[model samples]
Target: MSLRIVPVSFHEACSFVDEWHRHHRAPQGHKFSIGAANEADELVGVAIIGRPVARPLDDRLTLEVTRMATNGTPNACSLLYGAAWRAAKALGYRRLVTYLQAEESGVSLRAVQWKIVAHLPPRRGWSTGCRPRTARGTDNVARTRWEARIAT
Candidate 1:
């Protein structure tokens, strides 16, 4: 299917966030999200980012990309990540962050131009604890982190 990143309005975001929480309820809790829309304008993927309310000691806003998903194809995740990075940059965020699960081995996070900052701690409950009751597949998970600097 055709995939594109679009600006989700406040009301639209609310609905998507609600649906996301229903599916994935990880430990730190869900945060604002940038969404991926298909040809039919249906939300097929989401990249949730944690924008810290208070700036930490680093002075750079730590944007924790709490989640990423696709309707089926893994390619969808890269595009969604690109979209979220662009969005976060435009919003004055200094950096973008995300973690891949422990068992998701086949889940490829390496994109041609994206940077791999570190190997993060394995996420505890992406599929079992917070994933949607209907979600399937769990072997490709792993502890991974991806980051992009938004500003100099």
Candidate 2:
């Protein structure tokens, strides 16, 4: 089935991710969100772009794909990834990044020309002794960071 990129609200995207994402819970917030809709106008997937969670990369010009979830729709993810980069560039951002669990084959990202930039080893959960946070089961899982340059 063909898919078209469309605007999505943060709440709407979060709902979809909460129901569909395999490895992640819904994100806390986002700069923007995009959706993929099939010919029937039903949402098949969503991408949430937000400020980088990593402090060093949280500059004004960089954004991250904080969450992307789909109902196993073919090409829906690649469509959202490509659309997110184009939208970011149009809004003057310089780069966009995303992370995938090591177990995932990043075929969708590669389909859109996103390059793997780093292989991050598993780490302790985000919680610190002083700043305790809830465990989301993401700790101790290796991740691959991918990036794409926004066209000038």
Candidate 3:
């Protein structure tokens, strides 16, 4: 089956992620979003791009794939990742990044030439006595951060 990129509103993208993401909920906000559709014009995947979660990395020139979800479509995830980077670059962004649970093989990322640049240790949920938050963390698992290379 073939796939194509389609324009997706943030709300639509979030809704897709909320329904299909394996272990996380939709993000709070995004700079933009992309959709992958099948020949029938049905949305099969989505990728939400937003500011970097790490405050220090929120350099305006950089954008992050805050979330991605697919209905188990082959190559859909990789296509969305590649499309997200191209879209970001077209909008004049210098970098596109994403974080994934360490257990994830990142085959999709590797297929598109995105390389792991950092390893983030597991963390307790972003909660504290001063500002208690929900425990919907990444299951307290470590993560690997990836970045797309500049195309030649």
Best by TM-score: 2
Estimated TM-score for each candidate: 0.61, 0.96, 0.94
lDDT values of the candidates? 0.59, 0.95, 0.92
TM-score of candidate 3 against the unseen true structure: 0.94
- Give the distance in Å from residue 127's predicted Cα in candidate 2 to where it truly belongs: 0.6
Better of 1 and 2 by TM-score: 2
Q: Under the 3 Å rule for N, CA and C atoms, how many clashes does model 1 have?
A: 13
Q: What shift in Å separates residue 110 of candidate 2 from its native position after superposition?
A: 0.6
Ranking by TM-score: 2, 3, 1
Q: Please write out the lDDT profile of model 1 over residues 72-106, one tens digit for every residue.
A: 54466778777777777787777777655544442
In candidate 3, residue 114 scores what lDDT?
95
lDDT assessment of candidate 3: 0.92
lDDT of 3 by residue, 1-152 (tens): 98999999999999999899988899999999999999999999999999999899998899999999999999999999999998999999999999989999999999999999999998877788998888875658999999985655
**lDDT comparing candidate 2 with the true structure:** 0.95
Cα RMSD (angstroms) for every candidate in the order listed: 6.7, 1.2, 1.6
Q: Which stretches of candidate 2 lie over 4 Å from their true place?
A: none
Highest lDDT among the candidates is held by which one?
A: 2
